[model samples]
Target: MSEGHENAGWRRLFGGDDLTFGTGFPLTGTRESRPDVDEEMRLAAHAEDLGFDALWARDVPLYWPRFGDAGQTFDPWTWLSHVAAHTDEVALGTASVVLPLRHPLHVAKSAASLDHLSGGRLVLGVATGDRDPEFDAFGLDHEARGARFREAVDCLRTVWSEEFPAASGEWGELDGDLDLVPKPTTETVPLLPTGRSRQSMEWLGDHGDGWLFYHLPDDTLDSYLDRWREAAGEKPYAMVVRTELADDPAADPEPRHQGYRAGSEWFVDYFRRLEEMGVDHVLVGADGDDPERGLTRLAETVVERV
Candidate 1:
């Protein structure tokens, strides 16, 4: 119902409640290692061929060994642009980008440019920096990220939707004399606020085009969905689930990280349950020795079936 949902990428992902699927980056599940680019590209294209609706890239500005994840080992915008060239139709997403660490001008320009080049296929998920080291490295006060996050959201919307928009913030000042050009392919890109991002549900619901949440227990997730419906109306609800499809179609699921390790049979049922509960999209952090193969298997069994 939002203006930006008119964009092709947004419509593709949230057009229905059948629970569309996406694959997350760091496909190899490596914490400290950089994945092979060629193979990643193959998988990126493969995912689209397999009928996955989107490919998500994470923003890891620096690999804090303590954190143990390097994301995709490429800048989200650049890597997504490369992926945009490799595949057609599938949406491009940032799982998300750390907002407090970068200036909104950069985010606005980069996001708008990607949306332009990708033919309106960009969905920008934004968040406050997750790691304290990133805040220090960016020379920002860690305590002020919540406020900065709000300002950055406003700044991005202002710049993208207005010509020569004037605004001021801790990041910088924008005067009406200068305009940000190459506006997005839609009214503006649909922004999905990642996690809480230090904001209350009311704000996330009011401001974000959608919500990106993490895996949660059944009762907890149901509660979240209920609250989300109340706060966000029919705006989409998307979440990440760790999926590792085993060779046995009947294998049971066990808890891993924020999601589950299960057979694709279970996953089909799992996803249906999510869809019934009003989830619009599900991003799979699929894990395996050969993640590409696992993705294919999941698509064959779960994505197609669900």
Candidate 2:
């Protein structure tokens, strides 16, 4: 809950009470193929210009036909770094990086490097990963992901915050003989656990800097927020909603998978409700024929008005 860190990006996104908006990547309509790098970069810069608080990138190491979504179709570290260089001020976040799939040392190194490079704009959302096929492909035990997740988090915190030659249980042994260079601008990068990650609510509150969860109904969201407050005690809570904005300003809401298909008016009211319920940041996936137009419309109609 303390904002004494050097990362201005973290301060800008989570340091206030007003609801903030962020857009998911791929900033284009291409779902099955890779997005045009130039177009995505342009839209990313445009989003920053439009006053979006953050830009989210996903980690999808491999594509699965059943999963159906490629998720920005880029390596999250590289993509965030590229976006970091293109825009200034807006926070750059990973919608999530699958921690159990990769080594904690590598993740810590890369994340710290990015934090320094971007002047502390990185917010890392990590998960145990949901894809069964990915676990098989990686030659990892899907069932053990939860345990691995805990260990990886411990490793990250130790290496980022403690002095060189730190020793972590089971994660690895970092002898004082050598050190991980380029520590984060802050004492530690903000780590937000996506969903439960097979962890208890108390554990999340104690360990995570914040919580990143999926969309929920009004009643459910309220209950969850209440529990989170009891457990996490003012730690930030973020959610993602997949929206398809309508052209009509007065359009009502129609439910989608986890979000809604609605007009600007409904969105404005919905966001206000979320703010009232104490939700911190909302990362939006505004799906439409013209993704850029969808982003601009939300920025103008919903973000500005709210």
Alpha-carbon runs more than 4 Å astray in model 2: 3-6
CA lDDT scores, all candidates in order:
0.88, 0.88
Model 1: per-residue Cα lDDT over 18-122, one tens digit each: 788998886666657888888888888888999999999999988898887888888999999998998899999999999888888999999999998898899
Q: What's the TM-score of every candidate structure?
A: 0.97, 0.97
What candidate 1 gets wrong by more than 4 Å, as runs, is none
Which ten residues in a row are the worst by lDDT in model 2? 1-10
Task: Indicate the residue-level lDDT of 234 in model 2.
Answer: 90
Q: Clash number for every model?
A: 0, 2
- Pairs that collide, model 1: none
